[model samples]
Target: MNLSEHYNALFKKSSELILSGNYTIDSKINDESDRRFGITLLVRPNEEIKANIQAFLKELKKTEPHQYYYPNSDIHITIMSLISCYQGFSLDKFSMSEYVDIIEKSLVDVNEIQIDFQGVTLSPSAIMLQGFPTDNSLNVLRDKLRENFKSSSLPQSIDSRYIITAAHSTIMRFQKKLENPEKLIEVIEKFRNHNFGKFTAEKIELVFNDWYQREKNTVNMCDLYLR
Candidate 1:
């Protein structure tokens, strides 16, 4: 299996789980979408960090080989993922333009944001590069988004807790049957001290990653920078 195959399989598995009535798609969707949240502005990796992730993946392969290999997408972090309902939630250019205006006018400014991926850690299921949050730019954008939707009469999933979520792009994911609990724990612990250097958050993009609809449009995640 290749990279696309791996992603397709994971999508299929998740869809199947939902279809089987085992999982309910409710406002509590975050618990299920650990990886897919919405369009988030991620700090692009410099050459050094890119090489490090490549080397890291290589080490991962040697530590625990699998039938399917993960394709290194080269994305360092996720800004946000489009909501699953975003496919059904149609927004015309006019409406989107108005929303953009609101976002632009109410946005906040941040000097810099940084997060260092140190070591590895195991979530409930998958292995992850653990790090602390230092980026307020993206968070400000997310907040602006909520305010934008509220004032524009656009229905949004309520997220009142204002949880400080960590931002990292998933390098790979495994199905339940394919999980190797012991090896995963071992690998995560070994790389717990892995040093991924800091990168700046210059701008955020409202990327239209509508995988289901097969459409994308990039808008500055900040309204202040809108052209």
Candidate 2:
């Protein structure tokens, strides 16, 4: 299937799971005391897109009041997970300058990625902003990162969990049993075609972050600006 078809299937699957009561609940991913750190590169949607998302979220909050909603500060499009999270991970053990150099070099000639944020999609445990990149610039950037990182001396667990091929961003994750899945599904269906506008990403952040990418738990290591 094509990229659009693949994500459409994902949305349909999640919707079916919700209606049939077969979805997974949240895991201990939000555990405050558990320490797991990973490095991730991501892009943030501009203010116009954020405003559109906030408007939709205002409506969704009334439907699922107890679930975790991502704050405006944390909304981002992940470019790559340079390293997957693991317990007791620390930046002190690695060469931060090396990572910065490699990232800056990898970004060379990578054009700005234009994205259209529209609709909602979900996995069994979370709701996401369905992002569609207009071209293959996103893929090129990702491949360059992997290629450069692999050629370097640094150890990385990039895509060990899975390779990222889509452009969606998680907006909400279930932390408790869905009190009323039908009502939540109603909200999903209502704004499933939301147009959050389009913007070209001018920068990407490389961060050392917690599993959740919560702003309080994240530290920005460097930023790579695009053309």
Candidate 3:
């Protein structure tokens, strides 16, 4: 099928998945000490691109004001979760700093990556703007980091189900079962092939949790600039 047809089919399947309650909605734990550190490409969309996305969200809010929209500061494409400082697992600040150093050293030869945002899709948790990189730079970067983390003595955050094959930036999330799910689908259908613009990911960040909060935002512990 074509692009529009493909996304339409995905929308239908994802909507059904949401209704089926088969997936879990990601949430942050209450305690500050329980938050996890994640490696990610924090996207800073240009003014034109940001304005375009904000405009769409403005229109969507008219019909679904209860939906949780991601603020500009919170937008990012997660690469991999590094370590958690929760429960009996203790990752001290010094250790986290060491991991950040390792990440920086590992990605020294990587170049800036070009990414294009297009279309929109629904997931069990949120509405997302799909991201496509211009080349295999992102995949190569992820694999390099993965190998580095695997060989390190650090306590790696292991979630067997977590994988990042494709990138998507979250737009908004459902607060409750939508009163009219079709309306949201209609909006997505309109932008199924919309070009939301492009940006270069020049830096990768080691972001601390609180990145997921609406009221608050992510704190970048450190960043590694691409060559």
RMSD of each: 10.0, 1.4, 3.9
Q: In model 2, which range of ten residues has the least summed lDDT?
A: 1-10
Task: Tell me the tens digit of each residue's lDDT in model 1 across 12-33.
Answer: 4544453343432223222333
The order by descending lDDT is 2, 3, 1
Error of 2 at 131 (Å): 0.6
lDDT of 2 by residue, 1-227 (tens): 26668778988999899889888877675676779898898999998888888887888789878888888899998899988989999988767888889888887868788989878888998999888999888888889889999998898988899989889988888888888899998898888887888989888888999888889989998877786
TM-score for each predicted model, relative to the true structure? 0.60, 0.95, 0.80
Q: In candidate 3, residue 90 scores what lDDT?
A: 26
Give the winner by TM-score: 2
Off by over 4 Å in 2: none
Candidate 3 residues 196-224, lDDT tens each?
99988767777655435332635566777
Identify the leading candidate in terms of lDDT.
2
What's the lDDT of the predicted structure labeled candidate 3? 0.66
Global lDDT scores for all candidate models: 0.46, 0.86, 0.66
lDDT of 2 at 217: 87
Q: Count the backbone clashes (under 3 Å) in each candidate.
A: 13, 0, 0
lDDT of 3 at 163: 64
Position 58, candidate 3: lDDT? 86
